[model samples]
Target: MFKAFVKIAVLLSLTASMAFGYQAIRLNVSEGTYKERNDAFNGILEVDLEDAGFTPKDIHPKIEYYYKLFYGTKLLKDGKPNPQFKTDYVGNLDNLGFITISNEEWMRELLMKEPKLGSFAPLNYLIYKKKSEDKTYVGTLTPQAMLDIAEIKDAGVRAAFTEKIDALSDATDEGMGGEVEYVEIDKLPAKTLIEWEIPFDRGEDVLDAKFDFMEKFEKAFEAEEYIIAGKRDFAEYWVDNDLENDKYDAYWVYSLCHFTFSYTVFNVWEHPELGASAPCSMYMYLDKDSSTLKVGMPSVDNWAVFGKITDPKRLQFIKDMDSKIKEIMTSLGAKEI
Candidate 1:
């Protein structure tokens, strides 16, 4: 009892909350090299996950986009780096990578209930190692944290979502045998998301219109040097499975990342775990018979509270990103609501 008390006291003393006094990232540390722990995490998932599309990219050169996310086609860059602003910046970490994972069947059930979950449909399995420390870290934003950011309150949705998240967490712990730590916080900022809507009349076939819209969406962001990191189509999944869901005409989400912006925050800074919140998931959906296409994403301003990033320069960058994203959305005809 005394030992547990001492550990809690020491842990609390050693830990500091990020921006909003809550730690959404859950860290699982193991005593091994990056390769060993990474292998372990993968090994455990092989049997459990429906399909693990392991898109892992190594970062060291202050980096480039491993792949640009395309809307319709899975084919983006040929798994090659997309060039962005060149910097002499060298990564201080040895191994830094992001792998998104999810249970597809479980996720499909919850999407109609809480489409906002797309903001974290595929949670980031962030892994990193420091050049100075001989340790490996694996983590993701906690299920509760994702719920908070997405503002989902359905009890059924919460239960199912957390069940899936806990399973993955257990697998991670089982594979990487080490200390499980948390970046703890009590709550997030009052406004956790930035959102907008683009109104349109779906003439005859909405499918063709969606395709055209996506092409413009992809090109516009790419022209601005934003990497479309990942994408998922929830409505398509239901169609394949023949699952009857009447909630929406279409639902999909995109993970966006600015190469230079990420390089500055993760590689140049001490907190690679921030990647858990990353490759920011922006969701677009149109309800059944609804003409307004709704778009929403977690606000980067929340990073101030979530990341506990106090540096003057870094704070400005996060603020600028919030502005930049809103600008891009509005430019694409999305009116901020």
Candidate 2:
């Protein structure tokens, strides 16, 4: 009876082994002649999931999209895995990589200990070469050959949503320009902010001109309560008002015409009441080559008023503000350069 039972156990083991073929995938690495020890190294490992009866199309759609976005179409044949059809599917593993291991290996040593989830999808498996000799570590998936495609899809969807939000926020320009006035209140102490437009032929000259302007502006506004901010490339003069504790900030940009200048001003505290709650106080763009300062207005209601800014009232408001700025610059002895 004992001999028969042992024979049956061996037969069952053989049948199971035959049902699932075991194969080892090997990857080779080499060090280049000019390679530095501290420098980062990168390489691609071509995996044959076809042997396991899997194809790229079986991967979660979102993971596939991310993979394409990062690595491009180098791996996919005609934008998809070839061999047409297969019984097994290549499972998405959170857009990190594909799971080619089987379920039996899920609870194995290295994979089980390593935490696999990451916000940024892993593009390459980074390897560190030991100082003494070259070493390679092999890592495997934990959940086995069969994986939860839904989990990977969910992570991909969440990442896509986050990227969309970031793009929206970056495009948003709140408190750029609004219905604002220059109020010279007598009760408030006058603060002087001097800006300069200097022309330079070379890069070094540009730095010198900027430094020279800061020195002169500092002397001109030194008596009043002022703060000198920014480096030589561009600088700002800020004056504080005691009455309402309002601050007047002025930024100067190089104009298209030589020695011509353009500037923008804002009362930091008062503008917030105008619904400008941007983390940045202001934005200024200068075309040094063209000598033009294109002052962009805050698009606080940009999303709400997009494509509708063509309305007569809105157009007039923008034109009026532009005219006012030009007039102010003229009064400050700034010729339109």
Candidate 3:
């Protein structure tokens, strides 16, 4: 049994070697203490990304979207979600948060050109404290990794994006008072783009009565045991607020959550920090000049790799999620591109 396990591990290592493309850049501060609701007590530090003449607000003025994931609190209050939730809490970790920061207009336009780049945008900063340990760690997914995952070829855009994120990184490091160190690998596992195209002449009504795209999209996932946690319409917000009125013909992102899957990952796996990618996002939109509605999402496998998930079982589960997403896209008349 030991020999067989070793052989399997060697085979998996070989497979990873052949497909290396990106690695994670992690910034960790291992000294600090965080109380519950860190998002509320830890005030956001204002940094000037544009003092050097860069305008991030041109994309989306609201730069930072902060949210706290009180994983411990949730389990303590509601022991009904899963059997594991009823387990005694003997861990040192008491609080956690996922901070998403991005210049939407800047990142969104780049993502529109290369949908795969969406994997790393809305960059995440993880904050957590262990009950047994006094130190709180604050970390981020490096800009370099995101660029590599997207295979971004534009030197100019890559430079600008990297510079923008570097500024943010500096601010975060300073705020947390943690030295930056990278957790890296020579080879990156395969990351797939689950995207499909839909033929539509009228873009605005794709989600309206004129088409069944939205209905079919939802039904397909529902059939697969996924539920719509919610939806965010960026276009509607822009129009209402009179910000970038003509930027997009239509734009929205759907938040998908599988209760069982989430329970296994968050509660059983005990990796609440992975909630940084929670409510898996899939975005769809129509370009003003194009009749086709482009829909796409970065594969969940990227998260598995970045999260350092080496267990074959867990990796396979992530792949299955990707396959399921592709199936839904196809069911909605979207041809995989």
Candidate 4:
């Protein structure tokens, strides 16, 4: 009986430790116009990252991705049918800044330990103005949170990821002098690896299937009333540029959106900042060793906790989206592993 009690206690402690699974790196820029501030923030990301020994691989793509989202959502809100939305709101609202940077090669190697970690790779950041506020806020989901939620158990890998994010945070605050807020969530669901696996040697069109699956996945979401905000084929770009190494062969991140759901949680709730998690990411990569294509994504549950979304409708939208992703993966012959 005592042994059983001790085991229960240990399990409870473990659960408690994982409750707060994320930290939000925040900065406030209050001096400039929304567009000026947004543009300055974009410059900040590039300068700060370069100063911190990191190189941002792409900026325009990320910015365009968000613009697509902003405009697509504007159309979705206009109640237009036939799968077309208005694009007239492009420059009407406050400008948004977005960018992506790849971690050091060593950090990428550490990712091999747990393929799911790729979801956090080419780390993305966003800077936006809230409707109720004058200051433009800059933030990113920290690497520590991604590692924790993905259940990364290697102490070394965990430390490395944390160090990388901490360094990025410091660089971001270089000249801003703003108090960076780290919102530690204390009630996150346990670490979850949302991945699917297929049976077969990878040589068999798993690569082709990756592309096909992405197409089907977008169509499926559209059929179910979702929008394809944007997508990045990281692996294709990497391989094309001869950036590929022996570690892995392919990778991609797809951004999806439900504007109606976002309207309630972001606009109605006055949590425009929550759009930081907008265009939710679904990433996939190949595991050369296992000869299996690994599909993984950080669940929407992270957004709920990190964004502090509590309304039933918002939460339900998250759950439904998660379920829908799984269903699409299954349809592609990849069973959740």
The prediction achieving the highest TM-score against the true structure is 1
Total clashing pairs for each candidate: 10, 13, 6, 1
Q: What lDDT score belongs to each candidate, Candidate 1 first?
A: 0.72, 0.25, 0.56, 0.60
Candidate 2: residue 143 lDDT (0-100)? 18
TM-score of each: 0.83, 0.19, 0.67, 0.72
Error of 1 at 204 (Å): 2.2
Q: Deviation in angstroms for 49 in model 3?
A: 9.9
Cα error, residue 231 of model 3, in Å, equals 4.9
lDDT (C-alpha) at residue 67 in model 3 = 14
Candidate number achieving the greatest lDDT relative to the actual structure: 1
What is model 4's C-alpha RMSD? 9.4
Q: Residues 59-127, candidate 3: write the lDDT tens digits.
A: 211111111122223343455543333234233345555444444555555654555454454444566
> What are the RMSDs of all candidates, in order?
6.5, 31.1, 10.0, 9.4
- Sorted on lDDT, best first, the list reads 1, 4, 3, 2
Q: After superposition, how far is residue 127 of candidate 3 from its true place, in Å?
A: 2.3
lDDT assessment of candidate 4: 0.60
Which stretches of candidate 2 lie above 4 Å from their native place?
1-204, 214-328, 331-337
Off by over 4 Å in 3: 1-23, 36-41, 45-92, 108-116, 201-248, 255-263, 270-279
Please provide, for model 1 over 1-337, each residue's C-alpha lDDT reduced to its tens digit, 9 standing for 90 to 100. 5434434543663464444356577787777766676677666555534322222332222122221122112433575543432334454676667765554466777887888887886667777777778888877888788998999999999998877776666656656667777777666888998889998568888877777788889998998889887777778778788888788888888878887677667766666778788778898888988899999999987667767777898889899999988888888889988
In order of TM-score, best first, we have: 1, 4, 3, 2
